[model samples]
Target chain A: MKYVITLLVGMVTGAVAFVLLLYYNPFVGNQSVSPLAVSELDLVDFSYSLLASDSIVFTNDGESHMQPHPAKVLQLWEPTVKMTRALVTILNDSRGQPAGLGVKFSSDSEKTRLINAEVVVDSVWHIYSPEHGTFFVDQTENFWPYLHDIVVPARLSGGDSWRGSWYGITSTGPGALGIARVTGGAGDFADTEGEAVESIAARAYSAITGPVAMTGKLTIALPRQEALP
Target chain B: MLKIFYLGIVMGIAAAAALVYIYPVVDQHREPSLITVRPNGGNSESFHIRLPGDRIMAGVTGSTELTPLALEWPEHDFLANMQTELFKVRNENDVVIGAASRMSGWSEQHGSFVEWVVHLPARGSMFMTMAAKPSADGYREGKLRAGTREFLTLNGTVIERFVNEADDSDSDNVGRIELVTALVGLPDELE
Candidate 1:
């Protein structure tokens, strides 16, 4: 009987101790190493090509050569733009995480709009343009969504390719009695749709270190909008 | 005594389990943290922290208050291209610490703004503010400002300051305006 009684007491004591341990939160302590620190090395190289199209409307005034005209004609203007870039590098920071990106372009070529643009990604992504200084790309911003979709996935290896489409509206010129004209009317506008395609292939030399290469193409074609007769 | 031993063993197991869970939480809470920048007019998404062994810890708590320091937008045809706004956070040495960007709308609206709060270890804290302005001539400009009140020990005390400006033309003929500022001092470790 004594033995059973002692056993019961011990069980009760142990249960109470367990409850206390949970309540006091004894597990709270410091970590020997920071989990946030990244220690791996990942090197990536990529190329991008783009072809896009937009629909534009142009106004044609047969009589007015330079001065303003009250009434004018309407015409459609379609402009196509093609851009390509090669040998972009993604570099890691001291923490072994993706910290910066550098893109090299041919300075002599006018087609290279972004020349030597360096982007640093720490708390925020900073795209540094020699002509524009630094620009921030956040999730709330327009540029972030497009670049994020392309750059984030392209950093990894194996089947890294993506395609998408976007649409926008543009207007030009002054108000001419609320007339629907392009470049000279009160409401001259162009509705544009753009498509982009990207393909990236990566080769990992080692478990912690490797090289990744990507090639992308974007084509933008502007279509003409006919006037209503 | 044998029953007591068994009870102790069970209690030890429970204690170990509890410690394992609490250790990480305590460690994370004490470390410098940051939150994910929420999309404009969208729900808040979880912030991710990369862990060892291909593990990731999501939904970590950190600051999301990004403040603008300066802004400059050149006059141009606004309707020709989509308007853009960019925000950057930098230390006193003019080193960029954080940044964010978004599309500016073509409307005469007021009070449209976004902010980010950054904490620098042993240096100080700062908040960046980027406010959208009314579109003029189809060109949209943003106002930038910075403050240290969120983590400032004293109100109105000058801790650090920065300025950022970006002005360039893109292929689309869109005149770009930039803001660059060194808003906070570097941490003691960095210095």
Candidate 2:
């Protein structure tokens, strides 16, 4: 009877300890909630330059001996586009695991852009856009340099502030490619620097051509939870 | 005593599993930061400029001949213009002090080419030039010159010539000129 009582007491103690350990396990709580729990995302304000030549000069010889012919100037429309706020929705795969994010742009009158999430060999999350290609999110820096994509930490609670820097070229555009790099948060941008080079045809047409440069600040504010519908 | 020992072993295994789950030890794969120079707007011919670390300068430049037209143009009066096109200069802190796309054109007379001189704030200066001409074998021969003049506050000028080449078309002639220079100094923070 003494031995049986001792075994029973040991079993009870072990079972209680096991239960406590299971309850306190941090990994089992929420993996998906920590990264993408935000209801709304603030807009990424971008300031860039649009460079083009007004006229062109073509000479037959390298000298003034031949009459210089003027080439036509190419026109540019809507040189700049500002990315507005987006509604964030978590997307789950067939296994009910967090797969990607479905973002609907507010400025485009509810046009949604799907961002596919991938875990490469590094075990870091890389977000992909069809238009912009794949880019890794530097959680430490809170910015992606290749794509110039910036975001406020979704895990931040109300009134929390964060900042980051980004620099790179846009993958696709209409005119000559523009290079841009910006650092800021909310409605404000700091050290915003970029240049838009004239297209090849435009450059060849206009003997004199250069890039249009721009520098400015951008500022943004996160809407409190109470403001969300 | 036996039960307690078994329970302890089980608890140890569980604890190890939890630790791994909470803080995973993963081998992160990080790609080196690459500064790419794309000349003639062609991605295929673009080359990467190496930036080893802070206070280091590195670059790569190449020139190639395009297909020559069947007709022969005057040798002395041939018009060829080569420009730096675009460049970004960064200091030790990886902050850009000056960035621009300056265009300069000149007729290809004997040994005539456009030269670009850029001054990077609190760092140093860079000089670059590109020149090309048609060879006797109906192929183009080109030359590229690029160098850096670094000014250290305490130290004198540190001049480094990165690329200087003059070759025929049979060599690696990829008709492009790029100069990348990084000077070492603590300049005022870029506003």
Candidate 3:
């Protein structure tokens, strides 16, 4: 009888622990030794040429499974912006599980999101092909390898007076980033996305139930940072 | 007694699960960061720099915030051509500081062009404000002519830097304005 009680107590304790684990969370574990040999990128086949027409590329030497910071330049002259950049981040769930990123673009200018692709944790990606206005990349999580020519329209041209908004997320909808552009380069960053390549905006982790809509910073200009005194 | 203990254990497990779920929310925090990108108003975009990166802040070019300027347009559209700098936020002698740009609209939709995205170490920022007096020149198509300088040109916002050997006085900080390319101007559609 004592053994039975002890076993019962132990089972309950484990169950309690599991419940708590599912509720509260801790700091997502730090980025492990990225398997990509982050330093070897200089020697690898990764090159700027990776970017094709209407696109740019940022090659990184990180863990094969890690999403790295794409090449990017944050600041530019307001009058004549010549380039653009992308902010890349790897989102991990409470259990430190990567919840893939869903990428999308919208010239519709009607809503804020233009979701077009999904970068699953399995290193697979899905991108919307303008040819059919449909999402592809059914096999890979990383689009960096096979993104083809696409029109990255400028955010605001004197001709269109348009505002292009792009957003990314995972299947669970936990991790996301919204990108906006004003002018030049169609702004379709396929390869290199930003200068001084690093995290541009804040990282948004999804809510527990699922990836809830994020209420993070929308624009990188004057991103509430200490850049300007 | 044994049954009581099991119920208590289950209760404890449930409580713990509840705690775990509420943790991330109670500790809601996000690092204030930004990925500087060229605004493309499109989905596929690119960023040149990550402003507020660790280094830019450490390597202070003596940044300054200039008074924002307001731009005026005509009653009827011309070709979004209007350029007239209002005031100069000077730090010219100050080499490599930061620049900020933001524009406001009165009646029409807020002009997205007013926001300064230039990464130039501004030595000066123009806090401009004025109302445009549009005449019957009527709106032009391609480019605005000098007769009606109403066309917005490259009214570059200048940020003065410390001259090679200029007096390094606090006032020595000065930047010049070289109206680069007003990407989104008083739209050509709007005269």
Number of the top TM-score candidate: 3
Give the residue spans of candidate 3 off by over 4 A: A1-67, A70-229, B25-191
Candidate 1 reference-contact recovery: 0.06
Task: Estimate the TM-score for candidate 3.
Answer: 0.23
Per-residue lDDT of A46-151 in model 2, one digit per residue for the tens?
A: 2211221111111111232213222211111111101111111222333443332221111111111111111111001111112111111111111122111222
State residue B104's C-alpha deviation in candidate 2, in Å.
Answer: 17
Model 2: which docking level applies?
incorrect
The residue-by-residue lDDT of candidate 1 on A115-208, one tens digit each, is 1121211111222222112222211001222233344444453544433332211110011211111110001111121111122222211112
Cα deviation in Å at residue B145, candidate 1? 9.4
lDDT of 3 by residue, B123-181 (tens): 11112221222224421111111100111232211221112223357343342332222
lDDT of 2 by residue, B102-181 (tens): 22333222223333333332222233232333335433222112222232221111122222243475355323233433
Candidate 1 lDDT over B1-191, as tens digits, reads 78666765576555555654444321101122232333432112111111111110011112132111111122223211323322232232333333223332222222133332332212223333343342444322222222222233221111111212222543323222222222222245235
Distance from true location, Cα of A8 in model 3, Å: 8.6
**What is the clash count for each candidate, in the order shown?**
48, 15, 135
Instruction: For model 3, report DockQ.
Output: 0.04
**Model 1 chain A worst lDDT run, 10 consecutive residues:** A76-85
TM-score of chain A of 3: 0.21
